[model samples]
Target: MKEMQGELATRALPDLVRDLHAAEATGTLEIEMQGQRRKLHFVRGEIYLPAATPLARRLAALLAEEHSDGHELTALVQRMVDLTSSWREGSYRFLESKDDSGGELVGPLPTLEFARLGGASTSPEAAEAPTESRPSAPPGPPATDPLAKLGGERARWITVPKRSGSFDPAEQWVLEQLRQPRTLRDLLEDSPVPRAELLETAAKLAAAGYLRSLDRPRVETGAFEFQSETLQRLRLRIASFLEEKPLDGDLESQRSRVMELLATREDLDHYQLLGIGPFASTDEVQRAYEEMARLVHPLRAEELGLAESAGALTELFDSMTTAYLTLSDNERRRDYDRQHGLGPEAATVTETSPTAARQEEREELARSYFERAMAYEARAEIHFAIEMLTLATATDPTHAEYFLNLGRLQARNPNWLRRAATSYLRGISLSPREIPPRLELARILEKLGELPRARVQYHTILRIDSTHQVALARRQELEERIAAENRGEGGLLGRFFRKG
Candidate 1:
């Protein structure tokens, strides 16, 4: 059969999967939505592999452990299924296949099991369910070795609503000791009950959401306190860098001094530029950008009449902007980290070859030009801004942001529309996954009366990010207008034929 596809809004995902399972379908189900993609593979109704985010993958891996008793896996799978069922927007397609030999087999998750897992009655009911009906022995913890670590905080029982029944004797004893924070080791050493029984009871309670594990309290050297101190020191360093005595020279000499200051700075890496630590979250990067923008943005510099040092200040601001652009994007950041040897598996290169040194020098020079362009742009000197930006791109064609800025500047004039399109295309070619340049290019195409081409660009973007609201709206509007125009032309032709 041809591939079956539909939007999530029109069809419930769980029901669709259930239908497929009933048919004993063997294929891959691909989901695209909300700027992310996921895949579920089946071999004759059994899920062979599920590709998703790191957290989901890790959860799945845990559930796949050979030694895990069935109970833990069931609980984990139930949680996973519940989470997956919540997604409301997306498109899914299932492609049928006859052979599925290579993928890792996960489950032939039955419809009955899926329903049972998703059912509200899975948890014990206080009024109707018997206390003795609950597991006499606690189920094993999900695929992980629960007994591995100790000496942290003990697990405490969460308060439940008053019920007629009480926990069994062993569970009661465990809960009483857990009232105060004590490690597994402490509990094992002191408990009157057997070690196996106590551990099992604790695991079950935790899984049932009756118990929660707390972290051991630390002294003055807590991670949060250290981070705050580090941020304060970073602020001081930036202030010191920005605070330079008035130079004794003309405009040209001051400009030279500004360039010198920018080039000689020892801290310009992506993390340092953003005032963040390594592997910072996108949210953290955005917060740092906003904070730094208030301090070193060109508009702020202009308001302060720092014209003499505009070039230097602009460069500093652009460096932060570049940092934000790179770090905010998942793909670009990974590539950036890999190129600069900043990633986890970065290898040591003891010897710096001549080519590498030259490359570094070229990059520094390119940045200098880029910074000067930003300075000119801030002053409303459009001609000078374009010139400097052009030189920057010539010096470093690989820098996607340089091309993007150039394209934006070029796009202002009607006469230079083609050039703007070319520049945006170049930027897109350099960093295909970057969305801003593509969005700009689509708008440019639409303005140039290339609606078909613009639609193609918008569609491409939707493929990348299904939930891109702007693109979706624009595409829909364009389609409606086109349809209306076609109907109008058809009516006019019919009227003319009748007149003849």
Candidate 2:
């Protein structure tokens, strides 16, 4: 009834079994030796082995080979005991379950003779003995190695201590799994080693407390802080959807997407509607249609701000569905294309990396959002412009121009100065050699009253481009003011560092 758990190295599994036997405890003794797990069932002090397990079957086979007459089950139990008693490194737990063992048993154990050897080989070479000679568990139920079911490539983990150095092939593979906060799925997928071995080794390491499972974070959304109500509303809803763990749905662009779909739906042919060329490869067309479906999914109407124009949205979606149906079929696609007079160009599969392909797609989509952002900026719809730019940056953060413009727009609002500074920093990181972002960053820093940092930034700009007039003038003026303040004379803005 009391707590029961400890390492076998010190506690000794034999001693623990003797305790359980003395208490007449009815339950299961779970042992984890390195990575291997084995269970012994007890019915009021008498031990029982789960039928058909490797150890059980091995003991049974050995009994027949020995031609033992002294209760075959007795010899087998002793053999199981011998194997377990020989284990010096492992952990153990005793779970009391008199009501039900949750285990199917083959036979009872012999504890009086538990420590006695049944002439069964417990040697290192004996462990490598063939399965036919060993008593294997019964096939009543599937294997209980539930950890092996962590078969997903997306399942991630983190390493503890993040220690390094020499490792066996298995250890090395597991280390790769824990190299970063990446998923075991990715680790297992990328490795050429057998999954069973890798998983088993990982299990052993985990048992030894060498690895830790991670609650991995979602994919990056490019750090968007939406500045408009509509976009913010959509962002929150998409976030909720993601939290609910949908199989797959569009968490990409929303309101503007509906507008784009409505504008082009009627004019573009089926192939064009699907955003594929006449001779587009099958995979390309399929992917394009999937994107279209996500955008026009009727369930997304309210969040996308298309509820008012639901009729148009519905019509566009129908066109998309028709396009997919037609283009997905080779014969139908060919006929539809012929009627449209779109002659086929050789459809060559470029075999581009999926990551590269996705990057290119994002670049194109973000460009559209960027152009729309500029239009909104031109019309003085600062909030709308900010939203579009947010989308552009979130979609493809590699573009320096997106962040530069985003910071500039955000700077127009006094309350957004801090965020503006962050945006400018991101832009500078992406475009270190480009002067525009650094200049804007300097300006934002000044507005935030970070005069010293602003001055430093200006100095950085001058280093990059000595002829730049604005940076030269700003840096010189800041230097003079800072110098004046340090000299105990108040500068233009005010005294800095209390004139000390």
Best by lDDT: 2
Each prediction's Cα lDDT score? 0.57, 0.60
What would the per-residue lDDT of candidate 1 be over residues 309-352, giving only the tens digit for each residue?
67667667656656666777787776666455342212112133
Per-residue lDDT, model 2, residue 163, is 33
C-alpha lDDT (0 to 100) for residue 473 of candidate 2: 93
lDDT comparing candidate 1 with the true structure: 0.57
lDDT of 1 at 196: 52
Candidate 2 versus truth, CA RMSD in Å, comes to 24.4
lDDT of 2: 0.60
**What CA RMSD would you report for each candidate?**
22.7, 24.4
List TM-score per model, in order: 0.28, 0.29
lDDT by residue (170-275, candidate 2, tens digit) is 7876765564456665565444454456667776665443554443223211112223454334445544554564425333334533554464354345654665
Error of 2 at 378 (Å): 2.4
Clash pairs, candidate 1, are none
In candidate 1, stretches whose alpha carbon ends up further than 4 angstroms from where it belongs are 50-70, 82-86, 100-103, 115-256, 260-500
